[model samples]
Target: MTTTPERTEPSTTAGERAMLEGWLEFHRETLERKCAGLTDEQLRTASVPPSDLSLLGLVRHMAEVERGWFRRTLAGEEAPPLYYDDADRDGDFHPAEEDTWEEARATWQAEITRARELAADRSLDDLAARTSRAGESYNLRWILTHMIEEYARHNGHADLLRECVDGSTGD
Candidate 1:
C-alpha cells in the first residue's frame, strides 16, 4: 500500500489552466468531502439494491482514469492499465482482501498528485496529439474539458453514493 499524499487546498490561477484547475479542484473537494469520516467497510458498501457503486470503488476508478488521461495519454508513458483487464473491467471497486482503506486512499492520492504535476507543466491548449481508445486523435484542450465532464459526472454519482453510505451531502 502507498501513502496518502498531503491535503491540498484550491489554488488561484488564470486562463484555460485556471478553468481546468478549477474543475479539478472542485472534483477533488467533492470526492474528499464525500469520503470524509468513512470506514473501509463503509467506503466499500454498495448503494441502492442492485448497484455496486461504492466510494472506494469510485476513488479507485477515478484514480485509474485520471492516470490514464493525464499521465499516460499526455505524458506518453507506457504502462499496463491501472485497472480493467480481460475479466474485470470494473475490478477497481471490488478490491480483494489485500486492499485496505489506506491503500484505497493512497491510490487516489498518487494519481491526483501525478495529475497536478502534469497540469502544472502543460497548458490546456497544449496538444494531446495521441490516438484515443477508439483510434481517434485528440487535443489537450479536449482532454481537459473531457476530464472535467468525467469528474463532474462521477462526482454526481459519488454524491448519491455518499448519501447512501452515510447520509451526508453537499458541495
Candidate 2:
C-alpha cells in the first residue's frame, strides 16, 4: 500500500497574512500531493475527450496565474506567460505532453517564491497596478483569495484526475 502525501497548514494563532498565506500554501501542496508519485506520462494524462485538462496543465496554468497576479499586476512588472500563447488563450491547458514535469514544477515553484516576495511587505489592501481584463482593479487581498479559489477548484479536478490515474485519494 502507498502512503498518503502529508499536507498541513499552520495553527490558528497566525496573523491574517499568515492565515491567508497558509491556506494558499495548503491548496498548493494539495495540488502537489495529487500529482505526487505520478510519472510524466501520468501527469500528462487528460480527462475524458473534448477536455485537455490534466494535472500538468493545472500546474502550468497556476504558475502563469501566479506570475500574472503577483509579479505583473502587483509588482508592476511586464510579465509574459511561461507556457502559453496570446493567440491560444487556453494554451496553458492544451498540448499537455510528457517529460515536462521537472520544468513545469520548477516554474510553478519559482512563481510561488516570487509571489511571496512581492507580497511580503505590501498590505493586503495595496492595489494591483495592472487592471483586470474587465477593466477593473484589485488588491493583494483579492489576489490572495483569488489564488486560493483557483487552487481549490483545480485541486478538486486534481483529485479526480489522480484517482482516475491511480486509486489514491485524500483531502
TM-score for each of the candidates: 0.84, 0.90
For candidate 2, write residues 1-171 as lDDT tens digits: 445467797568998888899999999889888888888898898864567788998898999999998999988898877777778888888645543878889999999999999999999999998888898889999999999999999999898888888877877
Task: List model 1 lDDT by residue over 1-171, tens digit each.
Answer: 433333454455656667667767777767776777787788888886598888888888888888888778887767466657779988886766566668877877888888788767766667664577898776677877888788889889888998887787776
Top-lDDT structure, candidate number? 2
Show pairs that collide, candidate 1.
Answer: 128-140
Clashing pairs in 2: none
Model 1 quality (TM-score): 0.84
Identify the runs in model 2 with alpha carbons over 4 angstroms from their true place. Answer: 1-6, 96-99
Deviating ranges (above 4 Å) for candidate 1: 1-14
lDDT of 1: 0.76
How far residue 94's Cα lies from its native spot in candidate 2, in Å, is 2.0
